[model samples]
Target chain A: MAASTIMKKTGAALVAPVGWLAALIDPPLRALQKATGLNGMAAFFLAPNMAIFGIFVLFPLVINFAYSMTGGSALFLSGRTYVGAEQYERLLTCENYLDKRSCVEDLFWNAAGNTALFVLFQVALMTVVAMITALILNRELRARGFWRAVFFFPVLLSPVVVGLIWRWILQRQGLLNYLLHQFGIDQVLWLTDRFWAFAAAIMVSVWAHMGFYALILLAGLQAIPKDLYEAAEMDGTRPARVFWRITLPLLMPNLIVVIVLALIRAVQIFDEVYVLTGGGPGTSTMFLTQYIYEIGFAQLIRNPGLAAAASILMGAVLVVLTLLQLAASRRNQNAGAAK
Target chain B: MGRITLDHIAKAYGSVEVLNDINLKIDDGELVVFVGPSGCGKSTLLRLIAGLDQPTAGDIRIDGAIVNRVPAADRGLAMVFQSYALYPHMTVRRNMAFGLENSHMPRKEIEARITEAARMLEIEAYLDRRPGQLSGGQRQRVAIGRAIVRNPTAFLLDEPLSNLDAELRVTMRAELASLHARLKTTMIYVTHDQVEAMTLADRIVVLRGGRIEQVDTPLNLFNKPENLFVAGFIGAPNMNFFPGQVEETLPDGLSVSFLDGQKTPVKAATNSGAAMGAVTLGVRPQHLHLAQDGEPQIPVQVRLVEALGAETVVHATASGGERVLAVLPGQPAIAKGDRIALSYRRDLLHAFDGDGMRLAGN
Candidate 1:
């Protein structure tokens, strides 16, 4: 009884300051609520977050669009020439859309081609590998947590660090070739050769990002009820049939999410690949992101307008993909509700 | 042809044993219910028989062959899970057809089976709707239909009616019994509800802490529960237990003295020459009646009275502070603090020895 009395005293002591603060603030808050309404109060509470979002996201987006319509090597919009659609025209102009060599901005076309191919291969490869990894990890294996951590370890590393680490291992005189040499194999140019460099870029990007995607898929896999699987097992379903009918359909929502997110990230792939390949071996690995960086900031004479135009185009594609993801998820939600 | 024999089945996860030394033979077409409280390994035992889980030790024989190595699909058994476990993504028809389709059954045959099962379940109108759209009872029917369409050698239901409301559960229970009569297929059901077990099972297996306590017809189990646990578990209001000691061994019965100093004659026999110093007397609430002037009496002070129009349940505290329940026919003039003597027939008294094993007698 004495201990409980002491506890009550301590509780009151702790609550006193909070009570004072609430009393001090309650009058103004109530007055504000009376002056405005619940919606206004909600907006008041949301003001800080909205301010940060507007400054960081919306403001820069408007600036980027403004820059896209102008052409110059100028750092400020005031010094730049307002040549509406000129930057877009230069990027779009080509003798033949297919042949990059016949285009006015051949490097831009080449980069676009490389990026398209990269997005196709990298997204497909990443999703499949991630799915396979998630399935394996979801099984009852020894040290399962350890294996999951190992798979997700790459996601914690900076993209630059991932790029540098892989470059050291995949370079001509690197660990991979050195190991191969010990096995009586000759050295091969991993980053210097055009095909090998492109392949290496794809491999490293998948290696770096697959873990994050796999974790998402793993969560999706776990959400499926164990009893459903048991019921299926009792029904005498083959493992393959079970996977196709039960696992796939249930996992479609997460799968759609992973695919679209991977697609967006793949299109924006530059940091790690740039650090690893440097768009080397006669621009064979140059993607649209690297091309934008080279024109906007890296070159001796910057073309911010052209770079902004390219980025806006990429943003358009991402928006379309985002819309697709939303539609797919909405359909899934409807189907789930119907079920 | 689905006479399942479980010979010395034992299951364990690492050092923790869930079920041990279980042996039973379920005759073909018999509907046996395994009844026990939760964590009794009843569900685990059912899973082992379904081939969803492999027993750590022993042979599970289906028909005449040992099928310990057979996969669940190959074992030819269907199970209705507690959650209904209906595929939420598929329409009711597709969910029912999934198993047959997996077996590579022809389209026409699969359709026919699904149609028949749907018709029998009275879910033909809801066949095109998914499980999420169906009511709990409808989903339950679909789950049963899914199992029925498989037409397996036997059916295993793991508390299939548990998710339904009380009224629906009663309705479904009758439906299931009727369905079993129509099918005459071997079924192994597991439930913790004694009423369901008593109403449904041809023979009920009473399990306790991973061991079979008793396996007998429901009425037999109720009439003669091999031990204290079965006696207490099988009754609704729970059989009232009174601490008692055997005072004298008579030629026809034994005279026992209760903690309240009430002496009663129990019509029970012991093993020849076995000592029975301390024992317990059990009497079902329904068997107890208001005592007459010259009858064996247990005087108790009424604490709570539950009047149910047709019957009244008197909750009273005996002299030794034991809570006694007496379900008297019609409303008795019983109320809190009323001191009344409860009595029972000598033959209706159940006596168990010190070890809780019932003394043998009718």
Candidate 2:
């Protein structure tokens, strides 16, 4: 019996290795087994990623949609009253709560206009400055690495830190005023004035985000073959013409990516506006995200349904814009490839 | 219609010198080719002449003007790169007109030049197509057409045919030769292939280790190579060398005794100051022949015979432990380990001294 047990154990060890060897020799059968085994294996491998995505992305999105149609305290998960589409209707139609005056202007529409203006100015300014900086850096210059580090350092700073730093710099009695004092100029209230506050916010956004776009543009510039420039040189083509005819066209695909990413990030402007003005010295810096926060958490009367509805509407707009940009990019890539 | 001159051109990057004192004058409408191994600075020299690079010391004159500080665009020259370097985004018409457009040439003149260049290159049908839509040879033709449209004083080509297949390279080589004949412009071509240099060059400049080895016509480079490096590099199945010593100085020639103690008369002038101790006898493979009985012959043990239809190459070892190759007409039936008598014409022999310098006179 002992001898038989030893033989059985040895056979068991040989079987495990032989099975592995057989799997390698016969790929089709092994693939079938792998396909059959994927549910268990995938669950083991992807459980953590799925859990994080579900908690952070899918769960929040579903909860927001559900909460938009219900009337409840965000703190109290249970005992919620279903209000159907009333929250959406109130969000779109109710102007009394939106504006305190007898004036017929809607606060949601105003906030959206502000967000649109902010996105337009910030994205355009950032893209142009970044591309120009990248072009300058791509040239044969002294201390290129040092310049790249200087430009890219701002991208590493947190958005809140950037906002706080710029707030102090732009304040009436702060660094700008100090510099102006040396130059014998008058002090200006940068944050209190609506135009100045908007301009300052846009400038700070461009400053913080310009480095990332510049780095991407720099990569694109570097990818252009040196021989192309040499060929241009041999052709008697001027430097300006080379930039227009070769460099700019070749850098289009990268520029599109930078513009799209900047647009998306710019539309989601929240932290800077929050830290800089807390939605204002008046309503000058009250952006869409701050509006949502105010309705949901900070208002005298907490309107969960209105805030949820606002959040859903904003999310839909963002999704549509992103998809439109992606589709345009895809078409451009196809056209480029076809050529 | 311009002659280019490079007067003592040298290039150095930091401490390491890449090109050292290169001096050559290319005559008007002549095709000069720079041929060398990789990293031999042949391309660097071409770039210097094309004004793509500035020399660290020396001047490059085009049409009697020093273009040392001139940019490549203002130098009145066009270059075709190895990669063709055509704009992938533009149609052929646009690519050819790009330089003219940059110069602010009028629309009508640009179109006229483009049409003329396209017709000359036989690429009229491909004018509307982008470079990516063309074949390798077609793209090469377009690159040439782009240069042709400019009507530059000189043309610079850097291994333009190296990217093509063997058959295409030959076809393009003939095309390039015809192009040069028709254009009649000073063209400096750079290549590492000796066959390309031999077929295309009016005068070939052979470079080695950042220095010029020899500058000569193709036949001259083949027949009268100045040094051991040029002799070995320029020919197929290179010249063979056998070790020998001067036996005695004759009235008309020198009698050299081979390693096997056989004495043969070599018609080479001996330097009076040179020692007659050791020498090397060089002979081309085609000069060696199979000998009959009662002729001056050297016995060889045939190791391998290669039949190449037109000519047979016999690889053998001589009795004195010297390896030799003999090229004979047609196929010769010979097997390994067979003893054969190889003979050669006495006057065809070339004698070199110990330092690889060719002996004078005959």
Best by DockQ: 1
Residue A190 Cα positional deviation in candidate 2, in Å, after optimal superposition: 2.9
Task: List, residue by residue over A104-212, the lDDT tens digit for candidate 2.
Answer: 3255666666888999999999999999999999988999999999999999999899989988998888899899989999888888888898888889889888999
lDDT score, candidate 2, position A329: 83
Task: Categorize the docking of model 1.
Answer: medium
The segments of candidate 2 whose C-alpha lies over 4 angstroms from its true place after superposition are A1-51, A72-77, A93-105, A328-339, B237-267, B272-355, B360-362
TM-score of chain A of each: 0.93, 0.82
What is every candidate's alpha-carbon RMSD to the true fold?
Answer: 2.2, 6.0
What's model 2's TM-score? 0.86
User: Which residue pairs in candidate 2 collide?
Assistant: none
Candidate 1 TM-score over all chains jointly: 0.96
Tell me the lDDT of model 1 at A176: 97
Q: Given candidate 2, what's the lDDT at residue B62?
A: 93
Deviating ranges (above 4 Å) for candidate 1 = A1-28, B270-275, B360-362
